[model samples]
Structure formats: structure tokens, C-alpha cells
Target: MKEPRPDEWRAAFAREFQEQSAARFEKIGKQLQFKLARITAEPLPAELHELFKKKEKALD
Candidate 1:
């Protein structure tokens, strides 16, 4: 059996990193969407709602 070259190992590592990062970002986006929707649906004081809105925007 042949061993992987350094460049091959580096390419594989980079590919894995990119896939993990994409998955992580996708999960985060879903979570943020759910949280924002829940916040919008629930009733709250004006100030707190605005605070959440700002946070949501900041995450974007």
C-alpha cells in the first residue's frame, strides 16, 4: 500500500475543515432562525424585543 503524500494529506485536511465549517454554519443559521422566530411570536416588552432584534441582526 502507498502512503499519502504531504500535499495529499494537506488537501484532505483542508477539505475536511471546509465541510465541518459549512455544517457548523448551517447549524448555527437554523438555530438563529428558530430563536428569532420564537422571539417574534412571543409577546414581550418593547425594549426587550428590540434588543433581540438587534442581536439577530448582529448575528447576520
Candidate 2:
């Protein structure tokens, strides 16, 4: 069989990279959701609450 052309190789690499990035983001999203659930189950520390308020003010 003939070897793949440069463009074909680039396309294949791009597709693989996209798939890997999507999968990684999906995993990170799930992990964040799990952590959020756990955090919500307990009382947040005062420092974190203050930090969140500061961030909110910064956003506004």
C-alpha cells in the first residue's frame, strides 16, 4: 500500500487529538460534578465562602 500523504497524516492526527481532548474534558467534567456533589453535602469552610464572595464581587 502507498504511504499516507502529509495532508492525510495531518487530518488523521487532528482527528485523534480532537477525540482525546473531548474525552479528557468529559472526564474532567464528570470529576467536577462528583466533587461538587460531595462539597454540597457538607458545610463549606468560612474561608471558601469568603473567597467565593470575593470572586462574585470581582465578576460584578
Candidate 3:
């Protein structure tokens, strides 16, 4: 069996690293979206709700 050249090995390593990083980022993004959806779907505490409303008004 022939060993891979150094450049070939480096390219393969880089491709694998990018794939793993993208997968990790996607997993984190999904978790954040789920958490945000849960928080927004439920009733908020009065103070927090009021604070968000004020922030929203400021943005408008």
C-alpha cells in the first residue's frame, strides 16, 4: 500500500476539519433557535415583558 503525500494528507485534514466545524456550528445554531422559540412562546414576567416592549418601542 502506498502512503499519501504530505500535501494530499494536509488537504484531506483541512476538508475534514471544515466539515466538523460546520456541523458543530449548525448544532449550536439549532439549539439556540429552539431555546429562543421556547422563551418567546411562553408568557414573560411582567418586568421582562415591559422591558422588551420598551426596547421594541425604542427601535421603532
Candidate 2 residue 23 C-alpha distance from true site, Å:
0.3
CA error at residue 45 for candidate 1, angstroms: 1.9
lDDT of 2 by residue, 1-60 (tens): 999999999999999999999999999999999999998899889999999999999999
Q: What tens-digit string does per-residue lDDT give for candidate 3 at 1-60?
A: 999999999999999999999999999999999999999899979999899999999999
Model 2: CA > 4 A from native: 44-60
Any idea what lDDT model 3 has?
Answer: 0.97
On the 0 to 100 scale, the lDDT of residue 22 in model 2 is 100
Name the regions of candidate 1 deviating beyond 4 angstroms: 46-60
Query: Which structure is stronger by lDDT: 2 or 3?
Result: 2
Q: What is the C-alpha lDDT of each candidate?
A: 0.98, 0.98, 0.97
Taking all chains together, the TM-score of candidate 2 against the true structure is 0.70
Backbone clash total, candidate 1: 0
